[model samples]
Target chain A: MNEQEHIDKLMLELRRGTITIGVLSQLSSPQYGYSLVTLLDEKGIHVEPGTLYPLLRRLEKQGLLDSSWDTNEARPRKYYVLSETGKSVYEQLCVEWQSIVSSLNDLILNKGDDVNGDG
Target chain B: MEMVNRYVYAVTQRLPQSQREDIAIELRGLIEDMLEERVGDGGNNTDKMVEEVLMELGSPRTMAHKYRGSKSYLIGPELYESFILVLKIVLISVGITLVGAFAIKTVINPVEILDHFIEFIVSTVTAIPQALGWVTLGFALGEYYGGFKAGDLKLDKNWMPSMLPPIPHPKKTIKRSEPIIAIVFYVILMGMFGFSSNYFGIFRFSDGEFVGVIPFLNEAKFPEYMPFLLLLLALFIVKECLKLISGKWTMKLVVCTTVVNLVALMVVYFMITSQSFWNPHFMEGLMNAGIVEQGTEGYEIMETIWKNVTGATVIIFIVALLWDIVDGMIKVRKK
Candidate 1:
């Protein structure tokens, strides 16, 4: 693969872990799939619908999110909110992510292999 | 514009039926809002502009995955890995249990038993395609009926063809029995194979032990069990009637009838055990009803015929039980 393709592949792996964090953070209040996508996009995360929908479903299945159907409208919509477990995990992930970033930053500045490192 | 509609559907389809419509509505609004921004005072083709908006959004599966946030195990596309994992585990476990049960039943013929085992495995593997067809049909029918009745597939007029393709509402939702039929077919299949072979006999409790009192037509100690045949026909009629009627009465009828049948069987077994009417002379008295045995060979042939008939009856009853179970599963899945 070309250097650009390699970079893109690595970027995807990094983005996947971050995307779950991003989704959980947004679900403080109940939001449907599209609304969440729009909110994420407006914030410059630019997540695709494919990646978001399945992740939300997985999270819900894992007991991290609570979902309910809204039948009051002509077209019923399912709204999702972060569960109690999800809030705690998201908070922990945030703390871990910050520490990792700081540690990586220090390594990049001190180490000679900074050019090849993306983190 | 058409492409955009497809894109919107892709993302929304993953959502629960209740949420899919609102997500579609919101997506259409987003696209329209974007189109308006791009075409401000410009008389360019609105169709081309909408198509561009969709291209920027990405493919339908991708969009759906985004809206879905994460793949929920429920109502998501079938996962081959997970499916294979489950199928392998279940099939292997069933195979092991069946082998163990068969080994305990017979001691003489190892080669014959192995031959039967190989045949069973081949038959079971070949049957999976059929199983999948029935399972998918049952699930789809349940979903369509369940969601449609709940008003989860509605569309708004503002969401035009450009934003969303108008899918025809499914007319005449499948009744609950449709998926049940698929389940019934599988149960009948399993029961047929189970009882005939020693491979985990359907009603058999342990080695050489039959759970129910089965009529042995081949044995000269007892005459033909005409009353048992009549009872089977009655059960068939009752099953058919349950299919026709759909209410509290149908379920009540099934439960009450099943209980009545069980009680009648128990009574018959008790009577037979109380009176030793299984003597050779008593059976000879039954021979007086019709044509007497022409020869010993004739008696042997008659015995084989009766044995086959009894086997067929047992299979039929098993099929009915399977049908009931599959029907129940369909109902539960929909709920």
Candidate 2:
């Protein structure tokens, strides 16, 4: 694979587990699969339907999401929501994310300081 | 080929009534979009475009998996392993039980016993692999694609209006022959088992050697357990008759019954044959000299017959059930 494709693959791996977590966080309101993909993309978290749909199903199967078909429109759209379990997991995930960010910040700054001292 | 499309429909035909149309519409849209994209700029013929897209998409299996998500690897590295595991456990247990029941008959004519079980095992083993492959494939696809979001798996308790037309002029009649059919099967099994010992002597024995006889009664010398056989056969036939009449019993029930019948028949055969000293007790009795054992030859023969018959029966029943379900829906549409 080219460097960009390799990077994309790596990025996909990183986002794979978290995309469902992110989607669940936003699914207090009902959202269909395709529309949900667009919403995640607009929010700077790009998730393709191939990845997103499966994750949504996994999360739903795990009792983290709820879905229903709304045929009110010309086309029926399956809408998903955060279940009670999903809400709890999403909250915990947010806390873990914050801690990871803070730790990374400390590590990066320490690396910068070490370089300066060496120079 | 158009025929291939019909085959695809036949498989997808079992999709739940409510979801079928939406799934079909989505599938059609995807196929159309792919075709349109292929035809764009490059003036590829429609046929070529379809062939190319379908080829890229791969088999119905691959397409089905794609929609369902990651099914080939979902079960395990080898998809057949879990089902093989299931078949191994089930068939082995049944085989052991069958052997124990038929031990007496097998001892008399060990060859026959070996032949019978070998045939059964070969057929059972072959069948289970295919069944497991398809069933696991479907389940994996459903699990992957249906994406059972929380609460969706629950039986929809909420009364939704039927999309299809309501039953017009409900028929309040039952098939009268259903009861008669059950009675006839019960009588036949009773009559067969009732004189089994005498019957084996006269028919199953040949040239002072035990030949091929029924499976479940392999161990037992018949006339001994005629009453038990009668009772069991009655229950079996009654259960089937009830299900046939009710129509409430789904295809799954029929499949279960068929499996049970095969297992029961194997047990019955072993019980019947074991009662004799010589494997071909009747023939040996006629000679009134030595124990002429037919050995495992009979078993091999039995096994072949069982495997072929069971395998064919399982496939036919599954296909018929699926076709009938789809046909039933189509009929409803017409009405």
Candidate 3:
């Protein structure tokens, strides 16, 4: 493929890996599907409403989030927030993410081809 | 508003029954939010804005795929390779069988050679796609219903480390050519006997030009066993297919092939040993051709074949079947 196509595919993979963590990090407070999409966009994550809605449902299914409908308005909005299990999971995930970022930064900055001997 | 409902309905219809209503409500609410954002202070949602918004969200099928997670295939990737493998075998088997069956019909009563040839081509062409459809349907059912047997094709929910299959010995692996050759062989036998023993005999030549022949089967009696022979062969072909799919001596495979082949062998034994199963006119035809006479060694050979045909057939069947059965049992039980 040309450079644009290769970059597009690689960027999709990169964004997919981080999108879950971005969504999880925001759900400490209750937010509905569309609100979550807008909230992430302001932070530059730019998740589609279609993607976020299904992901919210899946996270609820996995017991990583809890959901309830607030039908008080003219239209009902399903709200999602981090569950008890989700809180602990996200905290541990943050620790792993921090370690991975540093390791990757070190490799990128140093441009190391060998771990045994540095260039 | 109607367009929004149609889009919501399209997405939710693909989801499961229980999740449909909840997903529909949630999807409708998301659309309204997006439309409101698009219209802004004017607070009017137009058809153009709705169309643009839905188009941006993309196809309803893609929306459903996101909701359902990994269920977008009729035969998923896990089952695809096996499905194609079974399809090839089934198509080849159908082609071989149609060719054999048509050859018998054409031989028994010679119509115009072209008519039989046309019929063979037409039937084989029709049969292959029908076979393809059936094989696809079978694999699709297995895929959707958690396999023909639960976890038999892949992982089970109740899987344990101990449940993992043992690595088969290298020698125990079934060669692809083995089942392929056996399927052709079975197709031939089904063709040979189903129409009653004809076409197999010493051919007579007059002045080096081909003449009329003697057949080894009683034309009238063998057709009586036709249905049973066809059923036996169908079972044998299925067993061979299982072998082709498994590619090794899996317990499920070995047990199936051994039992099916043994039953087929029994039907074969009965058909071979039945009274007058051999053509009574075999010797008479030989004598009539003047190729053999009462005092000739050729006559003695023909008589031996005619009288002791059952014994010879029984020996051949037992030897062939015993090798297949014993080979399977031993391989499957290997540590």
lDDT by residue for model 2 (B275-311), tens: 3422433333423433333455654564455446435
Q: Is candidate 1 or candidate 3 better by DockQ?
A: 3
**Residue B81 lDDT, candidate 1, scale 0-100:** 38
Error of 3 at B335 (Å): 13
Candidate 2 lDDT at A79 equals 78
Per-model TM-score on C-alpha atoms = 0.38, 0.36, 0.77
lDDT of 1 by residue, A23-115 (tens): 988999999876787799999898865456556667887999999977786545668999999999999999999999999888878798666
Report the number of backbone clashes for model 1. 34
* Candidate topping DockQ: 3
- The superposed Cα distance between candidate 1 and the true structure at residue B330, in angstroms, equals 44
Clashes of each: 34, 50, 0
Model 3 lDDT per residue over B3-26, tens place: 888999999998999999999999
Please tell me which model should have the higher lDDT, number 1 or number 2: 1
List per-prediction Cα lDDT, in the order shown.
0.57, 0.56, 0.82
**lDDT for position B171 in model 2:** 31
**TM-score (0 to 1) for chain A, all models?**
0.89, 0.83, 0.93
What C-alpha lDDT, on a 0 to 100 scale, does residue B101 get in candidate 1?
40
**Chain A TM value for model 2:** 0.83
Classified by CAPRI criteria, candidate 3 counts as medium
| For every candidate, C-alpha RMSD to the true structure in Å | 18.6, 20.0, 5.1
Question: 1 or 3: which has the higher TM-score?
Answer: 3
